[model samples]
Target: MATRVLLLMALTLYIFPIATATFHVKGSVYCDTCRAGFETNATFYIRGARVGIQCKERKTMKVAFYSEGVTDSTGTYHIEVENDHRDNICECLLVKSPIKWCSTPDSGRDKSSIVLTHYQNGIVNHLHYANAMGYLRDEPLPECHKLLKYYLADSDV
Candidate 1:
């Protein structure tokens, strides 16, 4: 009887699945000299830019982890996977723009192909940017007048 009970307990423990939340380590890529938005006008390439991650809780609003990294000449930054805690929101921003007054996309809205991973540890490249305007264009502003509503909304910059 004692052996059977022990076996049953061990089986139960092995069958149970452990639940774990995933946090994100995210940041942006930028150029060292120009400071302008990387690949903005024409493939703004950032070589050796810095990247970092800041983890925070969702319900209680707490910071759990923070880490940083440097980008190659391609201006690509990287960070380790943030483990546990789904409610936490992650963001990557341009630290130093070559042009300080340059415009920035609205946070939480504009969709950039910024890499994102959900509960997984892997690099998601070419995430793509999305916003009111499809992409940065050199055409006259009046040409895209119809898109004013989407772009004019509260922006992150």
Candidate 2:
């Protein structure tokens, strides 16, 4: 009887894992023409930009799992990870851009860390928001100076 009870418990644990959570990482990409840190009126939401979510091994820092996607019409990309990433660290990173003029990833906003397999109050469950990443346009538009004034708090009106 004792042997049968132990076997049943082992099988039950194997069949049904303790953790049950899937993650949804959602974010957008943009083009920064003026070389300014943040978005301006001249900023453009880049459609079809390549974005990826990568989870690295905690001990070695080597990539363990990854997935990529192209931005939709609204410049948004959503990646769904099927397993719990509790033992690893993951981030949403800029991969590439389809537009010729805007192909350079902005160093400041290239990656955003995401926490999966958790629940927070007032926050959606199993959902992570990556900061909007941007690529630099080859050349800044002539009107960029005027449009950039909107983002400056000290600018003279």
Candidate 3:
């Protein structure tokens, strides 16, 4: 009985680390052509936009891990992060925009917080999805007022 228990323990030790060794963080970046705070019908995905994942120590506020990725043709970015960052605060940040006219980062939408620890999240696939980040256009599109009217109709304002 003792031998069987020991064997099971050995197997768990080997498999647990391998299962939680790495994680994948996925998200997309967009261009707010309408200059709206959020996505709209006229909004479009930004290809070649730069995005980054940064993990910082919660107590010391020091950077622990950092990596960058470029958006694909679909404006989606997938970053693979090594190890479990349970003790760090991780975020997906907007780095750059391919469109010069929409290069400014959107306020309150530039960075998204993401949890990277597999054990804490209770997720078996080890995939973490962050909120979409965006950049604002220097000038609103010609039909922005019309598009924004649709949104305002739902609000009291």
Candidate with maximal lDDT:
3
State the lDDT of candidate 1 residue by residue for 104-134, as single tens digits.
Answer: 4333322232233333433323232211111
lDDT of 1: 0.40
Off by over 4 Å in 2: 1-18, 119-124, 153-157
List residue ranges in candidate 3 displaced over 4 A. Answer: 1-20
Winner on TM-score (2 vs 3) = 3
lDDT of 1 at 11: 69
- For model 3 the local lDDT of residue 102 reads 91
Per-residue lDDT of 16-132 in model 2, one digit per residue for the tens?
544666778899999998978778877889999999999998999999889998899999999998787767889999999999999988898988888765432233366778889
Clash count in backbone of candidate 1: 24
Q: Write the per-residue lDDT of candidate 3 for residues 43-156, one digit (tens) a residue.
A: 999999999999999999899999999999998999999988888999999999989999999999999999887554556566789999999999999999998998899999
lDDT of 3: 0.90
Q: Where's the lowest-lDDT run of ten residues in candidate 1? A: 128-137
> Order of all candidates by lDDT, from best down to worst?
3, 2, 1
Off by over 4 Å in 1: 1-28, 31-43, 96-157
Global CA lDDT computed for model 2: 0.83
Question: What shift in Å separates residue 18 of candidate 2 from its native position after superposition?
Answer: 5.2
The stretch of ten residues in a row with the least summed lDDT in candidate 2 is: 116-125
The order by descending TM-score is 3, 2, 1
